[model samples]
Target: MSMNGREKITNKKRLKPAKIVWQVIVYLLLITGAIVMLIPFFWMLSTSLKESFQVFSFPPKWIPDPIKWDNYVLTFNSLPFGKWLVNTVIITASTIVGTLLSCTIVAYGFARFRARGRNVLFLVMLATMMLPSAVTMIPVFYLFKSLGWINTFYPLIVPAFFGNAFFIFLLRQFYMSIPTELEDAAKIDGLGTVGILWRIIVPLTMPALTTVAIFQFNGAWNDFMGPLLYLSKPDLYTLALGINFFKSQNDVQWNYLMAASLVTMLPSLILFFVGQKYFIEGISLSGGIKG
Candidate 1:
């Protein structure tokens, strides 16, 4: 009995150390992945503060001996940076508003109403999400050109009002999770369909709405191809298009470009961080829905 007890104690001690070793390994792997992901942002900051020559230096200096603050100022002065900033802001805001309102309404219809070909239409919408943007880009450009929306913000902002496939799907899932009893009760109180939707459904789905808004904001802010293809006038250029304008045939100012890129990313980053809590909750709630 004494020998059995000693053996059991020894085995317990050995298993504890093994578990601790596995935990340490996992922590090391997570930290390494985080550092790898952060490296590009660090490199951008380093290069943005370095001089033109130092940017191309061998061994890749991580720290600049003399930080050049002029790159940011020069970037703004060399292009219509202010105009680009305003254009991006307007497009992003408009897209967010349109996406939330239209997607929610469409999603509610698909989730609540049972009409002919509803399932087939929903599946078709889902299929569109799988289609590559490149396949439709040229056709969309020509369509917009015929409508005289080229060289204008209309092309950038108007399509968002039609609702996005993925966002509508997401909102539909959330709306399905909401109890039907609430809507039924509102109806008994003499509320119409639109009233129940506006008063009860929208309030309950605030987290999901916020999630859609954040995604739309990010998409509009980071969009490059649409702006490049549509907006020809220098005054209408967004930040994404303005970045291309900075790269001329003869001269490419890497430092200034990096500074401008960093500046362009700030708003999306701030918005994401601020709305992160709701975004997570919205995703979780949507995932819990049936069908």
Candidate 2:
């Protein structure tokens, strides 16, 4: 072989180790991060199975010796967890429905219609996002109180019937990405605007819609302040508020609290795992070019 060829082969062999080392370094960093993030969760799981006395044991037992699975059973027994779960589910479901319906219609109008002051209205809606919720919380609470919605599910679920700025933007962008030819075809077949939306646009936009649903589900499920502000009745308590009350007991049971938290967290984890594929795709598709 020529000397140049042998030199090239030697250089290639030398470069391979550097690439492997770089990859090894990256993997090590990622693994370290994963372990660091998981430690608190591991501690929670361990503490949940421990006896109340064992929770604060020195040096911190990473493993509960004789894992008391009954902690989970006791967690539900100590509170009205089932009723709280039902309340949360109802509020979350209503919020999702209202969000999807209002946002879709408003977004469809923004994406497809050419009306006066369209861009200005869009900007005004977007500007609302800049205003901190703290500024409006009291006024909104007063409005609900005036409407007799305080202590009722209406305060928790009714506001979502109005379009959310971010969700409208996300859905509008997704709508713009779709080709207009399909709508034209639907029109030629005598389908009206609502018909086109329901039959054509919605089916194509399932991924983005699912993303919105998941986002609202997470938000509504974990919300603390909304319920704290409007829901004065214990019978109307959602799981998040119920858990906060659990933490306030004069003699707090860390194990039971941890266990209840785990139960509260399980649905979100399961939903994310089930819909992660669409959630990611939807977000990517939502960043479409302006029409």
Candidate 3:
């Protein structure tokens, strides 16, 4: 055989082994990552289905022998689970709507307007995101108290209508990424700023808006501290606060608590999966802007 033909044969043999090695490596990494990410959820499900004793077993049982399907029933029966779920749904939905409307308006102003001190104000708003919620909790509580909003859903829902700094910043970044030429063209066609924003920018930014809605929904739904602090009445308690009420210093129901948690997480999970396309697009747009 010629030297060139021999070299070609050797290269082919080397390439086959390298391809196989890379394929094996990829599969190994994927399996390892899958196991790591799924372990917590698997544990949660196992505990939810297991008898109370099996939940805290030293050896850690992956599967329950006789699943206690009754735990879910017991959890709902023990508390006003239905009512709590309803309250959470109402608050979450209201918060999402309010946040989106308020944040989009604020973000549009920051992204499109050229008012004096606009950049400075935007920077100040961005700086507020760095301030911990814990730091402002007491002040906000006091402010709401003065307004007699305590023990009502107002504290949770009303603030959302005022806009959240972080969400506003996220949306502003996305808004800034939208080309200015479109707005200018609309202006030339007798569309005012508000008209252009409503007819053009908002429709174009639906993905980012949906992303903001999803995040706000999850945040409001999962919020424990704010609801716990604001709502003193059991009737107004959100799902998070309701779950806390299930626990006592003397005794606790691990199975029921886990079941409740699993239930509470379902809506956010469903929303995320449903809005994943818009969420991904929003994230991409967020990365494309400044502040």
Q: Which residue runs of candidate 1 sit more than 4 Å off their true CA positions?
A: 1-15, 278-282, 285-291
Location of the lowest summed lDDT over 10 successive residues in candidate 3: 282-291
TM-score ranking, best first: 2, 1, 3
lDDT of each: 0.89, 0.93, 0.86
lDDT of model 2 at residue 22? 100
TM-score of model number 1: 0.89
Measured by lDDT, the strongest candidate is 2
Residues 195-225 of candidate 1 have per-residue lDDT tens digits of 9889888877888888888878888999998
Tens-digit per-residue lDDT, 42-94, candidate 2 = 88899999999999989889899889999999889879999999999999999
- Better by lDDT, candidate 3 or 1: 1
On lDDT, the stronger of 1 and 2 is 2
- Candidate 3, residues 109-220: lDDT per residue as tens digits? 9988889999899899989998988999899899999999889899889888999898888888877878787878888999997899889888777777877887788788
What value does the lDDT take at residue 91 in candidate 3?
93
Candidate structures ordered by lDDT, highest first: 2, 1, 3
Model 3 pairs in collision: none
> Which pairs of residues collide in model 2?
none
lDDT-better candidate, 2 vs 3: 2
